[model samples]
Target: MEETRPAPADLRGYCGNCFGLCCVALPFARSADFAFDKPAGTPCRNLLADHTCGIHTELRRRGFAGCTVYDCLGAGQKVSQVVFEGRDGGRRMHEVFPVVRQLHELLTYLTEALALPAARPVHAELREALDRTDALTRGTPEELTALDVGAHRQAVARLLFEASELTRAKVRGRKKRHRGADLMGARLKGADLRGADLRGAYLIAADLTGADLRSADLIGADLRDADLGGADLTGALFLTQPQVDAARGNAGTRLPGSVGRPVHWAAGG
Candidate 1:
């Protein structure tokens, strides 16, 4: 796969080279989002042998709603092609599986950074970091085949932390408190919301649909529309997958976990 230029705001734009790793590397519980429980590193039931979703057209119908919300941030393909150099699956790279997963996780953070409004001031810095990481995806086969991906991921994680701090400072309220506040119709789409304490916040109709909510505390947040479709909420605290599945979103909507498409809203109703 040819390496393409990274866009300033589109995160999925980086995933062209991904090998659909998120579908295979993560775990999901049987709930409104998933018809059956699947453990980590195990192939999803809906995943075809060729790395495509077998029920791509019926994710919601099959009860794997969470699968519709995930994006790998292009790390899948980078790892597969650059790191593994077109290596086949079902081989003895089991020792390096963890490294691949970590890299994918880093890619998720980079993707979220590109979506944040607060990060705009430092977009150049973020873009540079992304490019460097992107370059890491083009190492020689020997370098890719024998790299300490864990260390590389940690360095990237540090850069992500710096970017996150810059972005989060913009969202943190002056008083650092927003309990039971009404934020409906708020234009918070694609905001950097990592670790925000949004407990019981009235977020109805708020356009936070594409916000990066990694590790955010959403204990009792009211989320409807606010377009979580395509948002990354991985590791978001106190947010149950069922709550996300029950919420309204279309195929274009993103979620915290899983890479399946949204359930047809009309049919679900």
Candidate 2:
């Protein structure tokens, strides 16, 4: 089967078509990221009756920075409109929303993996996985809630790793292997990290100014409070919006076409 390129918009959160599932289905605690504690299955106090945030514009200023970084990978609307058919199934919707969110996240990665020209050797396998994952999204709420998402995730993860390796292999010179490395607050200014394996690396508050990160596999990397000012992330693999949103950047920070610069980056956050 021929692989069709996936558009970034298709994997993005469209809250207008959603039922605020993220606000109620996910829990948060009082921390630097959140102002107060919110339990799962309960609507956030800021959530309006019409399924919008009352403080959407002021979320970051009001200590709800965590909310600003979240994207459902379009799962909120999928669960609201497709699985539940726009009816608020309450507990059922909440239960299924998280499951679908996980699936959607996987779909996002699979879609991206299929787009990598360097990973073309595995394109057929990637397409099959993408199709299967997409089909699973259309399953009944009962099927979704009971789905062994972890098992599926592991299987997809292996495929993604292979795709990452194939794409990163094209880069000349050393490919730094920092998989799951804890580098929080490390000074890496102007470092050359092209084609690096940085999966699950803790880069919290690290200074990455002018870093060369082209083609780096950043899947599951923690970049909270990291300075990305003047950093180049072009062609970075599996770099999600949430990770970008969690970091600090400047107008000079270069990004891949797949992910957008965080709005807060402009405000010097």
The estimated TM-scores of all candidates read 0.51, 0.97
Tell me the alpha-carbon RMSD of every candidate.
Answer: 8.9, 1.3
lDDT of 2 by residue, 1-269 (tens): 45554466757899999989999999999999999999999899999999999999999889999999999999998898899898988989999998988988988999889889999999888888888888888899889988999999999999999999999999999899999999999999999999999999999999999999999999999999999999999999999989999999999999999888887788886
**lDDT for 106 (candidate 1):** 50
lDDT of all predictions? 0.58, 0.92
User: Least accurate stretch of 10 residues (summed lDDT) in model 1?
Assistant: 7-16
Residue 167 of model 1: what lDDT? 50
Best candidate, TM-score? 2
RMSD of 1: 8.9
Model 2: residues >4 Å from true position, as ranges? 1-7
Off by over 4 Å in 1: 1-20, 91-132, 135-269
Q: Which candidate is the best by lDDT?
A: 2
lDDT of each residue in 1-269, candidate 1, tens digit only: 34344542322323345445666667778876578888877777667767777787777567765665544444566566656777755423333444544544454456556666655766666666666665655565445557778677667656655655565465445323355778877788788776676757888777766777775656557764445655777755445433464456655554454333434554442
